[model samples]
Target: MRNEKKKSFYQEFEVFSKRTATSPFQHQFCLLAPNEEVAMVMAQENFMRREPVADIWVVNRKHIRTLHPEEKRMLARIDNKDYRTTKGYGYLRKKWRQYEQKMLDEKEILSWGGDKK
Candidate 1:
């Protein structure tokens, strides 16, 4: 005989919420509940009683799929490309100094945007 009561007790529910208008739904934690109604009620006082929660969702864990540990290992790469940044243009500083001119680096360029008419 299938134990319906035991099956319902161990159901894993994933909790999520959106903090604000611009924010995406983020996973807060997991809980065990039989159905969405119970999970939704428990999620409030259980996880976000003291904080602001604009929205919430309770989803069965079995409904979600995620990547494996081995799949994440394929994202590694070496950082040998210094030529893509200002660090690669350090020689320009010395050349500008030889011509009696200040090196107009990032700081000087960004400051130009301050309080313009």
Candidate 2:
């Protein structure tokens, strides 16, 4: 049948685009195309015509990997990274003050490479 023939030739593709070079790519929509080239052309014509696009990505749906609910739960658990943050080391400030010395925090350390007068 005509429907069966078209289904065999077309593949589902997901389109993603970004407004600026530094901006992250966001999902625009999905469409069926015969190949990546056709998908890209179709995506630009359908989605990018109305807005500015810095980049375009056309990925076949089958090639995209996704995490299931169980896998997502594993990644969502608290990661015990508090020690890398200032709040976890708040007591250090008081300790340094007791010694009559200033504590070099993250911001101060990052400014070491900046211009100095």
Candidate 3:
């Protein structure tokens, strides 16, 4: 059928881009093309047409290594680590308030940026 032929005309191509000189390559999305030349030619207009793309790469889908469903399940984390976060020190807000001093929350601490004057 015509649909089958058109399907074969466009193989899956993974697109990637670099936003800036020091930025790392990132996966954008996938498209379909018949060959590497077609994939490369189509990569820009198909994915980065309206974005700032410093670079691009079009790879065949079969060349990618992806996590399996079971492997993906291993990425889960437990919810018992509140002690490792600011939420654990939430009482500091009330304590600081009692002292008539503002709580040095995350936004304030990050703004310090090595100069605490």
Candidate 4:
């Protein structure tokens, strides 16, 4: 087997999917295949067999640009803007409790535009 030749056409891919219409797209796993077509076919039978996947995305790893170790060290560290975070806002929840009302959390605010049940 030492003299055997391998096909370079098979590429690494990142697979992401969502289980339902309202569910966010999540990273399921990775796979190696010749192309997107084969990857989709394989993913359907091999990966999504037990889960209800509403969508499928197959992206080649080479096409994705990622930060290098040196780049990470060069980047500046920064604190998150307080307005963009949910922490340090527990006081709002306590205030709502005084009125016997539930607090509108991040999830509740984001679901304002979602279809009603």
- Angstrom error at residue 99, model 4: 18
Q: Rank the candidates by TM-score, best first.
A: 3, 2, 4, 1
Which residue pairs in candidate 3 have backbone atoms (N, alpha carbon, C) closer than 3 angstroms, thus clashing? 11-33
Expressed as tens digits, the lDDT of each residue in 12-109 for candidate 4 is 88998998888898888899898889988888887788878889888888999999999988786586667666886867877877655444465577
Q: Rate the local accuracy (lDDT) of all candidates.
A: 0.82, 0.90, 0.83, 0.80
RMSD of each: 10.3, 11.2, 10.9, 14.3
Per the 3 Å backbone cut-off, how many clashing residue pairs does candidate 4 have? 0
Best candidate, lDDT: 2
What candidate 2 gets wrong by more than 4 Å, as runs, is: 76-117
Clashing residue pairs for model 4: none
TM-score of 3: 0.60
Compared with the true structure, the alpha-carbon lDDT of candidate 2 equals 0.90
Candidate 2 lDDT trough over 10 residues, lowest sum: 98-107
Q: What is the TM-score of each candidate against the true structure?
A: 0.52, 0.59, 0.60, 0.58
Model with the higher TM-score, candidate 1 or 3: 3
Q: How many steric clashes does model 3 contain?
A: 1
lDDT by residue (24-96, candidate 1, tens digit) is 9999999888788888888987867768878888898999987789977776656677788889999988887
lDDT of 3 by residue, 1-117 (tens): 999999877789888889887899999888878899988888876767777888887889989899999999888875678779888999988887866544456557778798766
Evaluation by lDDT, superior candidate among 1 and 3: 3
